[model samples]
Target: MKKIKEVAGNNTSDLVEMNRSAIVRILQQMDVCSRADIAKITGLTQASITKIVAVLIDMGIVTEVGFVKGEGNRRSIGLRLNAEKNLVIGVKFSRHVFSIGVFDIRGKVYTQQETEFGLDEFASDVVVEMKKQIHDLLKKYKNVVAIGFAVPGPYLRKEGRIALVTKMPSWQNVNFVEEFENEFDKPVFIEQDANAGALAEWWFGNHGRPINSLAYFLAGEGVGSGIVDHDRLILGNLGIASEIGHISIDVKGPACECGNKGCLELYCSANALLKKAEEILPELFEEEYENRWEACNRVFLAAKEGNEKALELTEEIAEYLGYGCVTLINAYDPEIIVIGDSISQGGDLLLPTINKIVKERVIPEISGKVQIKISKLTVDPTLYGAAAIATDKVLRKPSEYLVSK
Candidate 1:
């Protein structure tokens, strides 16, 4: 399943970018904070925050709020994001849906949309629709400096060509950067959706985390994972890093699209769950998903409202999901594990149990600090990661964020 959650931080070099962005991200998160607070959160010196905030103010990306005067202290001026100053576009395409999002420099998605079409049809048709969307967005904002796509595979590092995208029909080895570049004549950044979602969580969702390694499980139409180590994305031996969902659990359970038996996708993905529901609960199949939104909502509502059958099915999926997470955690020793997918709509009702299973199954201390969480309902986290991809290419300087692919 592809995660459409867009958040900034798609690049390893991004946080390392001019350091000004680091300061801005810190300030943007807080309504208003003193320079000392910025320094405290970012480990940057007060002098650095002063210099960076100065440049940001000049760029009109931030503004100084009022000052706080305390009994033995001098008045300190607070700063906050100038959210109206600039805008970025986060565009994403998954198996069955399309999204066009407008975000601010703070990486907050202010205006957004989710569009559905045939997965086969979308792969071929997105270009035209995106072109029109781009045209319309540019006409209104005019200064949208960058746009990013949450792709399913790694792009060739230098040439920016997409490669090895198996789930996206006809998109394998396609040079999306070149296509989008020529069509829009703007910088089009692309990144793996799972990686993008993790970045969003690291940056905006779970900021200043005490832990290092994190596994972000994104479930939608297909399943995948993103890993970050020491604030950097782990690209694995061949940039095929975090293919968690494709891992064989049952081995002889069921044939997966990727040619493996009982792949996690067959059991955990929305498609798989819905397919099972059809056999177990034909009543639901009669109505159709109505759209992805309604489908997850219905299941989650049923799970929350104590529908026995729904709860049982949810537990079954959660058990597999938890077991798969165990494998990833054992391999990586991640500090945090974020679950983001259509199934996540079940929210706390789903994750607490998965957390329990993983902790019980994993070695004691190793699992202690690991946090299993559901992404915020409103933020399509991958979108912000796409925004971060745009920010990485355009705003960040060298040495800020680092990555292999």
Candidate 2:
């Protein structure tokens, strides 16, 4: 196959940049390898690979990690990325919980913590708490270069504020980027949670396939989608384009805050699933449903264990979710759709039904053999994704972010 630069027709400077990105990309995928292996994979000459690797090593981006035995007692030194040299911080905020993590350029987390908010706390308090955590981390580590915040709603790129995070009325119109940058004394980036999750999958979960296009669906208390096409994220004018939750699946059903009727989230979100469970298993809810999240988990566990009622309810939720996926697939024509967040905890019991319903709803021409799968990073995609966005700046242009040792 031809190289990426060959098809893109890059000039000398662009070619150089592409070569650097390719080298870093190879190292990221391989995690550790000999210089010869990198040259073979990147299709760069051995001399060129040596030159680039030497520069990277000098800049503290790559390090020699011992060696592997070769023929006749020869040892080939394995080079690995030095992710801990410079740290990037990732922050994610939900209604009741906030998470902060420090990650290396390769998106490996070095340290992380989650804090839950009390019922009456406001956005200012959240910001203060986040700043305190970051300040403490910086004093300890002292190498953080950038911070990324993943907000749960539309984040305006130009204004640098979160548009509207439902249920957390105090967070509306809050500028996380500005607030974080001011407090932490570092560059900050804000992205929709779903969009950040999509980035995480593409940057870290490629699994050596390197898919150029895919859709990541975040299905928590609300539903949203993050789309990547041609290896680039599609953020609309306000930086929140794919609000799948607001997509009206039923015109005559209940009204939504976005002025739509029967939005996808109303019927298919994790909250919606739990609500369905509450209605179907009223006695169970009365006794065991202490938390909404716990209730959602129990419902899925029951479905996985072949409980007839739970299975039937899960199928219904999957059908509604499939409707949203069908729309996403038809509109974007992505190669695959990865579903994450609390609802995905249903695991195998949830995927097949979602796949079946999407296949049934969409025309073959539109579906075009799209595959729907569960997220590999099922725990916290947004947190990793936020870190990826910060680190990606360094990866794409190492000269800008890498400080000479």
Top model by lDDT, which number? Answer: 2
Residue-wise C-alpha lDDT for candidate 1, range 309-380, written one tens digit per residue: 888888888887798789878887787788886777877777767887888898888778677777873667
Worst 10 residues of 1 by lDDT: 396-405
Error of 2 at 375 (Å): 1.2
List the candidate 1 regions with Cα displacement exceeding 4 Å: 1-17, 40-45, 69-73, 120-122, 153-168, 206-211, 392-395, 398-405
User: Candidate 2: where are CA atoms >4 Å away?
Assistant: 1-15, 36-44, 66-77, 286-292, 365-368
- The best candidate by TM-score is 2
Worst 10 residues of 2 by lDDT: 1-10
